[model samples]
Target chain A: MSEKHLQTGDALPPFGGKLRLFAMRFCPYAERSVLVLNAKNIPYDLVFINLDQKPEWIFNFSPRGAVPALEYEQGKGIFDSNVINVYLDEKYPEVPLQAADPLRRAQDKLIVENFSAAQSAYYTAAFNAQALQPSHLENYHKGLELLQKELETRGTKFLHGDQAGLVDYTLWPFLERFEALPLLGKSEYAIDKSKYDILLTYMESMKQVPAVKTYYLSADMHAKFTESRVKGDPNYNMLDSSAEVCCFRPRKKKE
Target chain B: MSEKHLQTGDALPPFGGKLRLFAMRFCPYAERSVLVLNAKNIPYDLVFINLDQKPEWIFNFSPRGAVPALEYEQGKGIFDSNVINVYLDEKYPEVPLQAADPLRRAQDKLIVENFSAAQSAYYTAAFNAQALQPSHLENYHKGLELLQKELETRGTKFLHGDQAGLVDYTLWPFLERFEALPLLGKSEYAIDKSKYDILLTYMESMKQVPAVKTYYLSADMHAKFTESRVKGDPNYNMLDSSAEVCCFRPRKKKE
Candidate 1:
């Protein structure tokens, strides 16, 4: 539950018999699984790890030492956000996050697939400004347009209908981070209110969702993290104080 | 049923009310779906397209004009092999190709995710030999070892229990082509029988699977195609003659 990212030489936390998620504080991919876990109301323990200087034990949970690896059983793990998310949805069907219809499920996946170009564009614009090009911006807008059109066609409160399902959860992390782009002086990456009224409304609704609200960070916070990351010394523990306060203040109130 | 790759000027084939798959002859990803369809006994139409000069309608089926797109309905299409395969498995549950257990399914996907390094290595060695490095070879061997170890541990005729399943069909395409690496002078990429006896036995058994046997190409044929591909002019229609004979000869015999 700590915002502090465990680095190399850090001891592996003892399994508390709850589902454990290996993630980094700022990774969008990791946020994906986090959102799913939250949405599903699945009981889980979050272990934030420093991706730059990964803990040795992360490899045990994820072969590539990537974030969003789920330790489903003791010493057994599944990596990849999509893989873990799908497994979690299936394993804990109490609150199913995916469409029951297989075709709809496939369509949901395609939406994610089609949106990948925008993600790549966001990365280039954020971390490697020099590499950012006109085409990258074009692709970024194109992806946004595609999503908007899909929303129009689907005509739902969320892409997942009445409730935000796996598709919505999967994409929300990236959309959440996209707001940071304009703050980082990349105004071209902005999702303009005029052009994206529906998207903006959906995003606002997502922010209000109890699950996302718990872990949502502001565009300003994301910009600060992006700046720190760009400077080559990411402040992974920047939110630790707030996290500690958030964790204990509730207990104090109950007492 | 033609092995001939349809180019830009070609007309879109009429939908016969059956499932239709858009694929390329030599693409491993496309072959994955074909194997699955064959395994499921799904009477589907196969449309081979020239990736370089893709037919305009290919975009209607696959936005990016990539292979293994499934036209499940008259006009609606779903792209991505995993997406299409999973949908097919779910839509037609009579012959399920995945494990009933969610955890095992996750494990199967993990195996594919882990083995991607070797697939990349194979691509480099096949098409970009100049870029091939010792690490690539090491990764390739590591993938084989991992798979062999998996076979030993599972102790099943195939990755999917007694019969070959999605996992088996997914990996088999690359394994089938791996044999050509040695023929292309990349002997280090070869799966040495002594080192991978279990894997070799598994591969032999997989080749005999009815689904695989129908579409299986010999190492020589794969090597020939590899050579053509590397020469900057892929002979996509090289197998057209044999395909024609195989298709008509059966009908002729019945008559």
Candidate 2:
């Protein structure tokens, strides 16, 4: 994968027969789909796009040109993280990511809906510090407390029993980013060990999930990206490299 | 069925084993769930709430106090129109509202997503007239054009084929309200018969569906409701009366 984002004037990459995911390297929403694909062990190609200078073809895949559009076929595609994730789960049902019970599925969606406040608070605190408020911090902690309560009630290694499910992957990207808030000088947004012992434990377990382990970034690394984004020039290509060793193939022997 | 807007002092209705849908009578989002419940022949109780002065118990059904919330169980509830609607469809698969094919299901969701701009434009035009803009109108028609083109390609009587599926029910609420725009004096949002002939035919066909037919409101009726809402005091109780006959039952003889 090239870390250089395809921008305006760039041609669409030639279609690969395997599934194609149009993503922004730093977008949490894109990361959700990537983590799901990886968890499901679906082989796919990833194409990063410059959000500020989106290529003309991005709209063809995603009407709004949003990241995480999946080109399931040669030309046709689906967008939205949840929508795409659900589609991929249903289409490739070899390893199901959703709950078997319909009601449980609805409850899972509710959990995601309920946690949105913290996600918003994190965004405001990290990217627009001036807009951050005491109420935002309150809401952030309220969301955390709710997650802790839920974790206690479920009493599982992960939210979806012994194994992480769609609900876990859906919320993991945002949780991964939340850790960066404290490093970004927003101590109020930190997940206090004493207060959120259970949620913190769940986070630790999630980090060990093989799928997340491969794509996980450190809080310090996320802080760096956040700072660059706050400066109006996102360091989207900070991870620039086309030669990273991938699981699909062994690294070529050093010549 | 009472048009009386239940306030904070209102008592929670007795629980019925059948599904209970808490909704705002005139909200398009709520209407989405109503149409779905009716379409599926699901025996559910409908309790309309005054959105401004909501019943205290609504929070038990929806944490944010937003409708339509479904009390799938006696005390437990699920919120969000899409969430509730999808739950109902999946929980009661006797009459499937979704396409059997996963890709088609993804496409159906895309159709609704692509139409959201138009839904937004209609909202502004109907309620916040001052904020209406040329771009809003452009996006509104763009959505309509996209739907029309989709209709041409799919060549189905309904977006879901012979039967009205989730996509139809999802988009119909907005289309039903779009007609009210012209009646409310926002002529720009009208679906002109000349340009939208096929789309108009589709609308007429949708009106004839037993589910939509039972809940269908005329453009004039919708206009009156929109006017009342725009005037600051939404006549939420305008439809008051549990006596009104529903598709599920015949009116009881008066003593």
Candidate 3:
């Protein structure tokens, strides 16, 4: 199925009739679109890209050469996780991932917006531990506290409702990665069972969701990937056994 | 109506039983929500916030105290321009601002995404000239060229259609601010008639949009405001003579 990331000088893969998504294996933003595609039960092909040595053709799919670019048609494409996810939900509306109420949807986006600081802190803690600050830890817990408060206010199994919807998928990737922070010796990011009982319960339910279950990587795997990335080389194909031979070769540092 | 920005020690304005939007006079993001409200012709009150001296109550409306937070109801609000704008469009569907087609909507967002480099260049040129580089100028023109090509492909008076829509309004604020760059002696940021014939024509058409025209500040006025901002004291009240007296008093730096 040619699931590999075609690097520089690699020929553009032949396009099948199905929708194709350009993604990076370990990117939370790319996971966003992937989760939306899975939740909608849409038939699509995923092409994992090596962000460090991106294929020349990626520019055709995404102007900025970023991930989560959806090729809706043969020659045309759209990028940005929010833009692509919204388009997928609207285009394939059989299984609606968004709320019927506009206010709920707006609130969902607000939750994502508010959580960005925590996301940044996670990135710093995971990949640049030397730069980590007290504020990063504070912001991370603040984000978790806000999420817990929101869960109590809504009295729902997930942020979207009883079922995991767009909001859950949008944030779950970060939560998935957040688990790895503690494993990487950053215990401050650990989600304490006592303090975050509600959030933990919600996370368990989200993990059980069929769509999330399929693409979900464990904390150990995320920690390994984070370590590789922190060492100045990212093992983007760690999960793909087919690409294990390439992983045996010495990694090249990006110029 | 006290449309003025309340600062520290000032009382939170009493609810007036109407939709209120917290904004700044020259902020591009704030202009986004304002333009959306104006386009929808939704009855809303505009309260220009002193971003430098944000009122203690602004935090209630916007968590980060950023401008363009929509106070939909008394004491309840939503932040982020995209979130607030989408809410306004859906909440008041009498005048639809987004494209009916999902693909078109996605394309519109991409256009904004692609044009962001130029917006940043505009910011650097206007406020921090020392940081300006050749690549910034190159990106600025690349953005203009891209817009011109899109206009040619769309073959419409506006990006949305005959009338300006959310896409048009979303990009207009930056274009409106870009004009000030030329007046600030940054000729490299100028959209010359010879170079941007199609884009210039489109810009002219947008200026005629009743929604845009109402809140539109002339380039000269924008230049004056930009100079003040670059000098570390933004003349947010320059256009409003009624609020000019407050501007004369020694402005206090935010704690």
Per-candidate TM-score against the hidden true structure: 0.94, 0.93, 0.96
Ranking by lDDT: 1, 3, 2
Name the regions of candidate 2 deviating beyond 4 angstroms: A242-255, B241-255
Q: Judged by TM-score relative to the true structure, which candidate is superior, 1 or 3?
A: 3
Model 1: residue A81 alpha-carbon error in angstroms: 0.5
Which candidate would rank higher by TM-score, 2 or 3? Answer: 3
CA displacement after TM-score superposition, residue A229 of candidate 3 (Å): 1.5
Q: What is the lDDT of candidate 3?
A: 0.89
lDDT for residue B187 in candidate 2, whole number 0-100 = 84
- Top candidate when judged by TM-score against the true structure: 3
Using TM-score as the measure, name the better of candidate 1 and candidate 2.
1
Residue A125 CA displacement from its true place in model 3, Å: 0.5
Query: What DockQ results do all the predictions give, each relative to the true complex?
Result: 0.76, 0.72, 0.92
* Tens-digit lDDT track of model 1 for B174-251: 999999999999888889988999999999999999999999999889999898778776777788986454422322
Error of 1 at B16 (Å): 1.3
List the candidate numbers ranked by DockQ, top first: 3, 1, 2
Query: Which residue pairs clash within candidate 3?
Result: none
Best by DockQ: 3
lDDT of 2 at B112: 92
- Model 1's lDDT to the true fold? 0.91
lDDT of 3 by residue, B210-254 (tens): 999988988998898888777787777776657655655887553
